[model samples]
Target: MKKNMDDVRFWPGNIVVAEAAVAAGCNFFGGYPITPSSEVAAHMALLLPKVGGHFIQMEDEMAAMGTVIGASLAGAKSLTATSGPGFSLKLENLGFGYIVEAPCVVVNVMRGGPSTGLPTQPAQADVMQARWGTHGDHPTIALTPAFHQEIYMETIRAFNLAEQFRMPVILLLDEVLGHLSEGVIPPKPGSFEIINRTKTTASPEDYVPYDTSEGDVPPFAPYFAGYRWHTTGLNHDRTGFPTTDPDTVTFDEKRLMRKVTGNRELIDKVEYFQADDAEIGIFAFGSTARAAMVAVKQARAKGIKAGLMRPLTIWPFPNNQVLAFSKQVKTIIVPEMNLGQIVYEVERSVHSDMPIHRINRVGGVPINPSEILAGIEEAA
Candidate 1:
């Protein structure tokens, strides 16, 4: 099983991503049919049985999540793939997954959205949605893939992060990356790192599902191995029992929050491309970032100093890294396939009054490079 990354052959990124997940021991996939993301589901459907894994195409988004959470509880590395609307539908279940500390991946092939916003269009609009859509003080791990090849690699990373944090990890995609045909050299089966969900060791008689030390990420024991544990949405105690003590709830909430939010350095991911003394920079994510990259180079060719800030991890925002570039640039342009979404977060983080322009396109088409280049100049 020894292989080098340099020796990897090219493949369609989604297929490589899917097969990598299979190779990483992702035994279960429950997803609904949605554009861009449907390939992941289709790939899983065909390949899972060959490797003795499970794949279920649910009747709807809700069912997809239901199956995902159910499978996760049984100690299977499980996940569900969907776009905007379907991602929205899975929020409640996402919350359930969070509180229960179930490790699974949620691949959101982001399409334009508020309500079926633009089914075929690419959007980073879900950037905020990925952060706040799910209820309460839970943490998130979201990775954005700008190209077909990274989609395969990042999906495996998402699973590793989920298992590491014992939280739901999101693979944020757009129509562009999901559907883009590109070559990827997938790692051989068992070649890439794999992380499994943590199991409990307190014994059934002394099990405390919510127990924790400083970090409070309780050791997670799998279900039905003669280990009795309870999981509920209600605020609970070390043993996973409902608690009314304000102090206990307060401690539990903070612990849950710290496990992910406090460890931003561990989760923050970004691609800072050519930001050395750049006057005009474009900030973008997912498929829109791909278009921005093209525009940035074209602008660079025209004697305008331009570059791209592409974030691999969207939810944690990589704000520290992004804002550092924002301070020096005269313009920080954000382009997406939605009317306006990520621009707000950028605006909120940057202190200077330098114009933060947004270039957006919706109605089933990706953002044109020309439009984004125009936006970059306008901001510049």
Candidate 2:
């Protein structure tokens, strides 16, 4: 397909976020229906066809992820969106995408819950799930956007990261961020970068799906059309075959890890407000980060040197950044909808430096800005 550089259409931020994936060349979606995150799938259902993409509502979350991996293996930019419970169910295939280094996007519109805790209420309980939900050792990129505009822009960015690293990227949005409607002007037509998968027309005699070249991400050729490729859940070599050969296994496993994990500079993004010359740092992500922002602004009004640290990329937690801030700040405030998930990461990253204070609300409501301000005050 020839690249279309023509200026496209502009849309509302919510619609633009959902539709931008199609514009960014994402054509396949497979997901089970769930609240909050469902809008992404729903939006794709209506919007994908106009751009020649495909949407499949599978029987369940696991199958949804499986379908995406299959579509991506066939050279399609694919994705799936879900929330808390749905995310838990998809871990197996999420791991599959990691082992195979399949390029796709998974959106988690976080809601309150261990098991269907709160459906409509907004919560950021899935922070660690977005990070370590899948088992074993593998690298993943997760982006948390705090508002409606971010939902659109972040989704586009997620697709790009997935293609560049040859791995699945997760867009971590909470219910508040997913459903929040705010006016936003999308990028002008032809302003977006749509990355397509790299395809090689190698002959049937010499092609391996996991063949490692100079890059951390090995080049892949699709099945059928004479390219013989084998994919599995077990650790394997570049030929994609099961093997216990320790050296080959170690190299392949670490290669998979380095493909995304080693490229943190390219993937690390955050929003900093009042960070410079601040005595306190309020660390947060997703929707909670929005409240943190307001709290930081209010703190500054009261002559408190407090800053908001929002990690736009959450999975590869910004440890180095946190360490730098911890050394400079007197206190750190970590808040979320969950009891104590991300706070643990913050604690670990900073070596328990300074006072690590936590204010969390787990009853299914988004902790308001005022409450966060009170927490910051208490820390101060």
Q: Which consecutive 10 residues in model 1 have the weakest lDDT in total? A: 8-17
lDDT of 2 by residue, 1-380 (tens): 22243533333333555776776778898989798777788888998888888889998999999999999888888988888899999998999998988899988878886798788777887777777889998887988877655666788889988988888999887777777765555566588776656665456787767766757777667756678888899988888889999999899888888876688888899888889988988898877888888899999999989998888888788998998889889889998888888898889899764789998898878888999999888878
Q: What TM-score would candidate 2 get against the native?
A: 0.93
CA lDDT, every model vs. true structure: 0.79, 0.82
Enumerate residue pairs that collide in model 2.
Answer: 8-189, 17-152
Candidate 1 lDDT over 298-349, as tens digits, reads 8888888998888888777666776788888887888877788778878877
Index of the highest-lDDT prediction: 2
Candidate 2 stretches with Cα past 4 Å from truth are 1-16
Clashing residue pairs in candidate 1 (N, C-alpha, C atoms within 3 angstroms)? 11-184, 17-152, 200-220, 200-221
lDDT of 2 at 125: 78
Total backbone collisions for each predicted model? 4, 2
Worst 10 residues of 2 by lDDT: 1-10
